[model samples]
Target: MRFNVWKRLELAAVTVGIAGVVLVGCAAPDEAGVSDARVAESFAAMYTQWLTEPDLTEMDRLVLDEAQRTGRVTQGQYQDAIDRLVSCMADAGYALQLTTYPSGVIEVQPPVAVPDGDDLMSSKHFCEKTTSIYAIMGYEMQQGNPELYADPAVVAFNCLEDADLLASTATVDDVKRFMYSSERDNFPFDSEDFGVKACFYGAGMAYGTVAEAE
Candidate 1:
């Protein structure tokens, strides 16, 4: 099947896992008609692109090549990536912890004392850059979002607009930028409504794990 590879967005940290992770806010080529194949194309392209980069470890290259060949990152592949990343982090002297969410997003929890910026990168970036980064993200795109809105925040903000919950003029980026900058706590939408939750679901983002919690 043909896929319209998405234009990768500069997604800021959605969960504070790693710096500059390629998830949560990746935009598609258009608002609709995008699909899992498209998402896979974007990810697979990255896999190929990384092959051109000299620094990628041979092990990582093997994993990426497999994903590209299959046009998707399977659960086994994603798990392997997580394992590789965790092992790499251990080698770097950081004992990072893994938190698994139902939607296939893994939270790599660095220690509380871990400093931000360069120090953080020095300790953890290689592992993340090489492994599982969006083996997690791309997998979720295929599983969770079929309608494929650019990102959950974009769709949800528009949903809110329909509900009169947001200013008529506010763009998705406008709202997201504000929330990230200041309101993080005081931000307007609660995401409790079923319809709003559906908006995020349709957008490929897990609303509170993207499943009915047991």
Candidate 2:
């Protein structure tokens, strides 16, 4: 599972390194200030939300329980959950591939060459619930957002300001537009960009399993 949260997946649709097109960075000016406790509370609530998910399998409940007790999902726990998801999908006859890009993006390929719109998503969701994407997201969130930005969009806003990639007066909405609007190739969030590369270092992209994944 190449789900390195610091890389491009942080801004992706799932916000968990699942075929995302942007990266996470660090070094925010005072404006992005957010309390660590607030961030942790929001993140905890997010992790808790999954506990009530109807799609969760019995195994998912066990993972969530361990996470609750620990207050953090160890690298091993996160990877184990990913392994379970892959295995579960395979068991269901949907062969899945988790591909890690050199840019540290992780993509879970579709199970089949061509799939029915409804069936493919349904099957993927079923298998996905067996694993906890939150464990990985929590790691990245901790890294790229040590301040624990309760708002995911704000994380990138600070990164943008830190990098001076955009105008100094840019609003969070403007950054949001950059995130949802810009193409990865032309934007500074791309791995090839030096500014974000610096942010990667600040974000501490390496720790335990996350280091190995990258």
Candidate 3:
């Protein structure tokens, strides 16, 4: 019950934050010709892809092993729970979608110009928000449809959240910090470097969640 409530609240917060960011980002850019919608859209679209494609079998093994290690469940029941979850995702039609606000001109000026304004602050802010957003989405999706996920769905939820959030942000280092936080350190996954490879691979897998789980 605690996990259920926590998951729901986190999801609501994420959806609201993402919605607020979309509203704010729709304004005109500062000096750059880019649209805030562009950034927001890109982030949303990419993260959707990450949630859809995972080796549910392998992930099942990992979750059960960790649960065993953490004493949540035994090895024998892990596969059964995973099978139930995969079925749930398939049955639920769990597709990710992006909602948006309209366009408007905001401002064009140098940034707030903090001591380390150019890259560091920009990276951290975007990364932190992105991580929060996906964590929220992951919690929402799996929790809202608990019948669709395996036991210990939180484990997969965290994995998808970590990867999806990092992949959604603006830069590589920030993404790494978001993905490799202490909360996720024991999860046994690698940090994805940014660039076309990370973008396509990381984001590509998320979209694959729409397809039937293997």
Candidate 4:
């Protein structure tokens, strides 16, 4: 399973050349010394907390209604989307523990120059991979259970969007600090590995290490 997951991730890196548009801003200079462990812990805690909070509120309903009326999704599809969203929230805890934290599986090499755009790209790809897994599960759910909702790509994109928004709250400086630590601990996967792009791809590959373990 781990091999397969990594294979898929490598394929994604090669084929999915979509430029990462999500920008997690930089941390303030004062926060530069923060540790990677702390950043990971903070993200895990906040993500778990966010999952516990109710998400399908009045605004969500209104958005669904609008999407239905506009024919973006049928009423049935809207309900299915809601169900998938709920399930994603519920699974956040296991996903964080299994795919994110163990052994610092999500590590990235630090940028020599501050405000490296690759850092944000790494985050975007990380979130996208998580959503892709959920999307696949959604597809399987539809085939096995008629009552379940699917539209895997749509759900995945929604998940990606939501994650992007959530990541914006993290202090960028702290994230960079963590990257530096990771670089210090695990640098130059090879002499050929060069620049932020290599580091970003490495981080992207690292994203699902925990999930593959499970």
Q: Would you estimate the TM-scores of all the predictions?
A: 0.52, 0.52, 0.18, 0.18
Clashes per candidate (backbone, < 3 Å): 0, 0, 11, 3
Question: What lDDT tens digits, residue by residue, belong to model 3 across residues 1-214?
Answer: 0011101222222422432333323445335333222212333332343334332244443443343334333323433443343334334332212211111111111222235434433543343332223332332333232221111222233334444633343343333333233342323233332221222222211111112123
lDDT per residue for candidate 2 within 1-214, as digits (tens), equals 1322223423222433232212233434355453222233444444565466565556556766676655555656656766776777677677766644233333455533545656656766676555665555554454456455534446655665765765546566554443454333333344434454434333333111223335
> Worst 10-residue stretch by lDDT in candidate 1?
1-10
| Candidate 2 Cα misplacement greater than 4 A, ranges | 1-56, 92-94, 100-107, 111-113, 131-146, 157-174, 182-214
lDDT, candidate 1, 1-214, per-residue tens: 1111111222212312222223334444345422112222255554454445455556556666776776566877667777877788788777866556455645455554555546656656566566655555545444444333344455446556665766455566654543334332334544444544444443433323223322
Q: Ten residues in a row with the worst lDDT in model 4?
A: 144-153
Against the reference, the lDDT scores of all candidates come to 0.49, 0.49, 0.29, 0.29
Ranking by TM-score: 2, 1, 3, 4
Q: Model 3 off-target regions past 4 Å?
A: 1-72, 94-176, 179-190, 193-214
Estimate, for each residue in 73-105, the C-alpha lDDT of model 4 and write its tens digit: 233443444344334534432111122222122
Better of 2 and 3 by lDDT: 2
TM-score of 2: 0.52
